[model samples]
Target chain A: MILTNIESVPGLRTVEHMGLVSGSTVRSKHVGRDLMAGLKNIFGGELKGYTELLNEAREEAIARMVKQAEALGANAVVNVRFSTSAVAAGAAELYAYGTAVRVE
Target chain B: MADIIVFIVLVACGYFIGGHRERSHYRSIFAREAATLELTLLSGKAIDPAWQVAQAALVTGVCVISVDYFKSVAAGLRNLVGGRVSAYESLIDRARREALLRMKAQAAALGGKVVVINVRLETSSISGMKADGRSGQVASVEVIAYGTALALA
Candidate 1:
């Protein structure tokens, strides 16, 4: 599937609006990693653990959003956007949203 | 001698109570499976696609519980004694499964076959600043699942 953050897909045209679609998740990782991350910001380099954690979270949220679009009989999701919020002491929420539409 | 005995007793009591509290917390959140059957039930109709699509907005929360710093040190010491680190493995597995289930429900609602490509996950610290001028941090992580829907021409 062609997944782009751009509102318009290169070749596909949105033929009909299938309405809004989204996927969201709240997650938490190791506290120790967080402390190391703060220290790493000053030192500068890769923080492997947190990086992996965030990457997984993003993938999961987007997958669900796309799934929602598909269920609506939408060929594509356009104007895709992501947002994050603090949900709990050790958790954060990630949300992906887009316009679900039939493309031609 | 009496003061030392009292200190040791107090520490033991604290450990016992803390362990019980942790167990209860896990039982409350980790063991319970969120209702997923609702998605299949709702999808029984070809009704308003928009409303059906909106159902994907359901917020899923996945908590990745790891060993506390003290616990990690203890575990490390236990590892030296040839003990298993089963708790760490269990925590990671549970977090991954929870995220997957949430995505699956969203996908099922969208009538999508699977979540594929360009998947991303993000994590942030939720805690405020600490007295040591360091940020008191709580971790929040998110998983983004996305894919394409195919139509038979």
Candidate 2:
């Protein structure tokens, strides 16, 4: 489905507004990954493992959002936005939300 | 004696990993940025038709970065000196760039053109393993890059 963070798609016109569709997931790193990340921290750069972890969570969240949009018969999700919160010390939650619409 | 040894190990490890790794990462980011310069990545909010967007989708990328024991200690020291803790600079820089690149990759993967607009970069600090709440240092950070991927319609 087409997704954009803008209120309206430039060339396309909106035919139907299917309301809000949102998806969220909470995730935490494993001890093994944490230790590896800690080790990587000593020489600061990218924490690939944690990055991947969050990315995975984000993608899953997006998938859920898309499913909701599909259920609403939306061909696109517009004005999509992302938010993150610390669920716990080691746990994080990623949320994706947007307005589902049919555009042509 | 053991304490001194531990300190030396921490510092040495940081030097090798943090210092060397950051330099190499900078080189890689710089190269990739130059190569991708032709691609449009904007921080604007408007949906500009100049993009000739035939199809569009939301694309996102995320990165997490942290400091080693050595840089944390250095940061603590810099706190006392009341100056910039250069230790954390590269951490944020790398996270931001990496997040943006990932977003771009996602956009390109979906048949979207290299142009991605209305990009938003958000950052947050995640608490580390030390949940005791005593050390309050932000041991890690998460950078999120989100944008609209406008491809030729």
Candidate 3:
């Protein structure tokens, strides 16, 4: 399967537009990670734990989106976009959406 | 008071340590940006038809950066005056640049000369908040950069 954020994939012509597919996931920080983040907050720097957690969540969201595209007989997802929102105090929702297409 | 003393110490530590880290991060960003200058990045949705493309794939980079105690305090003060919060500006700038560089590195891994098109950047604040939402603190900001990378033979 191929994924591209542009309208079409390079060197491949989109044969059919399979409408839109989307996936989302919500994650909350565990206590251990939160404690470490609190300490890191005092000094200001990259939150590696949070970064890795969110990265995994985002990838899972994308995978779910790809699964939907595959179900619709699409070979690729195009014009992909991502959005994130804080659902609760320490929980965040990551959403991935795109247009599924058959490219040849 | 002990609380006041702790606040001062935290602020001092944040100032000295955070400042040093920011400088080093900037140095690294500058050097890596120069090293990856060969990879072209574009926000336009379409690619030039003249170039022969070998492969195309999606590439993404993400960064979660937090503001130090000193900068957050400075920003809070700036908020009262309704002026530009310069303290937070550098944080956002660094996050965006770092995310872009990571995206470039991913594209370079695809082999051959790569041009990333349709680049999109999104920023969101991911800080814990109280149930009532009144105590929502700006602990960190997340920046995500994504695009389609086309490798040319």
Candidate 4:
């Protein structure tokens, strides 16, 4: 699927605007991973475990968005935006939203 | 006596792991940056008129970094005295740069030359109030680097 954050695609013209489609997911690491990350925290470096967790969550969110766009019979998602928030200690929410549109 | 021992250990751990990892990450960033010198990355909203965007896609990279136990302790002390927490400065810096590198890597993998416009960075702290019935402490933060990738038509 073609997704762009700009108002319009450069080559193709937007034919229809399908309002807004969004996807959200909340995720946290397991206890084993958290413990390992906490130990690394003492050394102050990249927490690979948490990084992988959030990365997966983001991809999943985007996938859901793509599914929504497909359901709307849209060829692309435009003006896409992403947001992340802490839902609770150790839990985070990633949200992706955009305008689904048909470009021709 | 025990407190002194713990203090020394924390500093030792920070120097051994955090310091080493930071130095290596910097070196890697600079090296990879030179390799990707031809690509463009900008924060402006306008795309170049000379180029026609054949395909546009959104790419993202994420990095989560944690403050070492020693640094957090130092930060707490600095909070009392009202000065810069020098330890965390590099931690955040590393996170931002690493996140950007990952974004660039994604752009390259997609056979794209540059990140056209609308670059955004989001940062959030997510290591607190453990969901697993363990200690809830805020030591790690998540950084996301996102932008649009445009391929030449």
Best by DockQ: 4
Q: Single out the weakest 10-residue window by summed lDDT for candidate 2 chain B.
A: B129-138
lDDT of 3 by residue, A1-104 (tens): 89999888889999999999999998767877877777887898898877777788789899999999999999999989999877764566789999999999
Highest lDDT: give the candidate number: 3
lDDT per residue for candidate 2 within B70-148, as digits (tens), equals: 7788878888878777877777778899889888878777674557889998764444433342442337768999998
i-RMS, each model, one decimal: 12.6, 2.8, 2.2, 2.4
| Cα lDDT tens digits for candidate 1, A1-104 | 34444454544566788888999877667778677654433222233455466556667878999898888888777656677665554454667888887866
What lDDT tens digits, residue by residue, belong to model 1 across residues B1-153? 999886565445434543454466546434434444332222111223223221122223233333333333344567787767663444444454555555445445555432222233333444332324243442222233332222111
**Clash numbers, per candidate:** 37, 8, 0, 4
Off by over 4 Å in 2: B110-113, B124-138
| Displacement of the residue A58 alpha carbon in candidate 1, Å | 0.4
Taking all chains together, the TM-score of candidate 1 against the true structure is: 0.41
**TM-score of the first chain in candidate 2 relative to the native first chain:** 0.94
Stretches of candidate 1 above 4 Å error?
Answer: A31-44, B1-134, B138-153
Stretches of candidate 3 above 4 Å error? B129-138
Per-model CA lDDT versus the true structure: 0.49, 0.78, 0.86, 0.81
Q: How would you encode candidate 2's per-residue C-alpha lDDT over A47-83 as one tens digit per residue?
A: 7777777778778888999999999889988888888
Give Cα distance to truth, residue B84, candidate 4, Å: 2.4
